[model samples]
Target: MNTAAYFAQIYREPDPFQYRQRWYEARKRALTLACLPRQRYRNAWELGCSNGVLSAALAERCDALLGTDLSAAALADAASSTAAFANVRFEQAHHPQDWPTGQFDLIVVSEVGYYLSAPDLSEMATRLRTSLADDGLLLACHWVHPFAEALSSAAEVHEALAGGLVEAFTYRDADLVMQGWGVSPTSVAACEGLR
Candidate 1:
């Protein structure tokens, strides 16, 4: 399937993934937020920020956030959903080929990685390493179940991206797998000087 066309068709409805209505999505977002070792970040990037529901939540913890999507329709939805946040912006990007210029203190990859080919994912992992700041963190979340469009499994995606980084945290359920890596991995309590 044409990736852009597929997502464009999916975005025919405003909430294609039911991000706003689904309890699972909401809880995943909450877990993603809670898993961050730092309370706030200077700069953040969210890949595949379809409709920007998570971007809106991430904006609260970031001084500046860039949300990128491959589909124009998805970017439009993301822009509208995140309009209230002055700190958040949306862009059209096809990753592992298209990348932002600056480094980010926080990078989020959710539900998008499985769509990339293994070679592309490998390249993306390299780019992610370069784009991440010295004290940055990378978080990824994906549905565990296989789907027609997925070129790779969640485990494969995570393995490809997590290479050379220190793992910070992880969460797994029957439906999803979420993991984070950092330049210098530290626990939340350690970040808060509790340990």
Candidate 2:
């Protein structure tokens, strides 16, 4: 099955990944948010936003946020989930191919990279670097264990996405791996003039 169909099938369950209920999911989201180097972003885009659980949280920190997913069902759920957020918008997009035209100060790739083939991931990395604002940041998080549907390992996905970007930080556990990348190599303390 293709990625869209696979996701569409699973999304029929509304909260297929239990992103809203699982403690692991909540903790991961919190960690992702806390790891961000800045308190606010002018513009942000979340690739494969799923049901907008994380998108809504991100909306709180961004002036404008765009969430994209390949599944219409997922987008519908995302819109409903983030209905109160005027700064958030949802769209249907197949990454690296249906990419948006503008740059974003924050681009999030979460739980979606492993679905792409190697070539697609490479193209995505290149596009991500170019689409990022000069001082922008890129964050990617994914499951570490092998899964039947995943086309690539989490390591491969992160490596491809890390191309042309400086490592910011990484968090890993048995279940997941999360990393942040950006143009500058500075730490949060350095950015805050504490270093």
Candidate 3:
């Protein structure tokens, strides 16, 4: 199946990923947010923001936020899900091919990298160098356990990110791997002159 059809089927359910109702999803969002070195970003972009569960929370931390998804149905859900946030907007885009123009201070690829094949993910990683600002942060979170829909492993996805990217932070559990990267790196305390 193509990207749109696959996601179309997935979005048929009211909450296919159980992001709103699952402790795992909720806790994952908290962990993702907690891992950010900076409290606020000038501009943030999330790739494959299905249903916008995380996007809603990110909106609170970003001056301007863009959430991209492949399916119109999913974008509709995302739009409504983040409707209260005037700073947030939803756009339809296919990955790698339609990456938005301009740089972003915060770029998130959570749960979406493994869906791409290794070559595609590699291309994405390459594009990220140019897409991200010099002082920007790029984060990715993915399930460590293999699933049928996963075309690549979490390791392969993160490995792609490691090329030319400085690791800013890392978190690993048996179930998930989360990390943040940048060109020039510093700890949260360092960014705040606490160190």
Candidate 4:
């Protein structure tokens, strides 16, 4: 489906699969957040933040958090849900080519990577590598189940990111898979220290 049509459907009816409503999704989000290397972060950027449910959770751990989506309708819902958090902002944005200008201490790629083609995913990997701060952390989570229109699989996205980064750890089960990357050795050491 075209991006416009695809997003239009989502705008019309938000998919609970990506939201924090279901037990499966809630569990995945919790696991994603728990794997972070730090207790708190100065800034975080979450891409494809559908309805901001996880964004709300992330705001508690970040001094400043920006959640972006290609669909304005999604941002509307996000803005409403995150209104109480002064440190959180929502915007309509596309990835890789339109990545935000500043560095991010933490970046979340929840269910966003599969929307890109393989080459675009590679470009995104490069952009992510450049955008992360020296001691920053990157968390990636995606559903392992296949959709016919998806350009790549969850494993492929993780592989692309792994190729560009040093993998800190990973979590996987029947429903979803997550990968963590630390930008520097210090962050890796810190993650190891917790074990």
Candidate 5:
């Protein structure tokens, strides 16, 4: 099945991925938010924003945020879930193809890269290299376990995205890998001139 159709069917349940009820998801959200080096971003984009759970949290820190999903159902849920946040909006996009134009200070790809084939993953990296702001941070989080839907493994996904970028931080667990990459990677303490 194509990614869009697959997601649309699953989203018929309106939270099929259980963003609100799943412990793993809750923990992942917390970890992703905490790992961000900056407290505020001028603009941010979240690819494959399942239900806007993360986007809602991100809205608190970004002047503007865009969340893209493959399915209208998911986007609708995302829009509703994030209705209170004026800075947040949901759009439907086909990934690497429908990617938004203009540079972003923050671009997050969470659990979405593995769905693309190796070539497409490479293309995504290329886009990230150019679409990202010079001082931008690209954060990626993915599941470590292999699944039937995965076109690439977590290692391949992260490796593909990290190309030509500097790794700022990384967190690994038995089930997931979360990391951030950027230009001129620096330490938080260093950003604060502690060193």
Candidate 6:
């Protein structure tokens, strides 16, 4: 089945994903949030924000946050859940092709990379390169287990971003893996006192 269909099926009845009750997901989200380079961000974008649980957490640190998902049902749930946060917005968007314009100080890819084909993920990374602002941060959190529709493994997706960017942080557990990257120039400077 296609990525959209597969996700639609999950959203139709997401108990199997167990995003809320599972300790694995909670731990991964915590790890993802901890690895961020900055304590606060001006603008943040989270693609494939499955029900907006993490998006709500991201809203606390971001001045403006946009969370997108392909499933309408998911978006509805997200909107209702995050209604109190005026800075948080939810939309229905697909990746690589339907990406929103403008630069973001923080970009998050959580549990979404495996849906795309290798080439598509590469293109998404390229787009991320251009869309990300200087000193911006990118966080990728993915499940470590195998799935039938996944085009690439979590390691491969993390590896694709290595050559072009600098790895800032990483957290791995039995259920999830998280990686953080900062673009060149400011990358090393941020490590030193230059920035």
Worst 10 residues of 6 by lDDT: 184-193
On the 0 to 100 scale, the lDDT of residue 185 in model 6 is 34
109-166 per-residue lDDT for model 1 (tens digits): 9998999988999999999999999899999999999988999999999999899999
lDDT of each: 0.92, 0.92, 0.91, 0.84, 0.91, 0.83
On the 0 to 100 scale, the lDDT of residue 97 in model 4 is: 67
lDDT of 6: 0.83
Model 6, range 1-195, lDDT digits (tens) per residue?
Answer: 487887788788854477789887787778778777677899999988888888888999999999989988888888876888999988798888898878998999987878878898898888888888877988888888997878888888877655587777878878778888878433445665677
RMSD versus native structure for model 6: 2.7
What is the Cα-based TM-score of model 2?
0.97
Q: What is the lDDT of residue 42 in candidate 1?
A: 97
Mark the regions of model 6 whose C-alpha exceeds 4 Å error after superposition.
14-16, 184-195
Error of 2 at 18 (Å): 0.5
lDDT of 5 by residue, 147-190 (tens): 99999999999999898899989999999999899977758898
The per-prediction tally of clashing pairs is 0, 0, 0, 0, 0, 0
Cα lDDT, model 5, residue 189: 91
TM-score of 3: 0.97
Which runs in model 5 stand beyond 4 Å of their true positions? none
- Model 4 RMSD in Å is 2.2
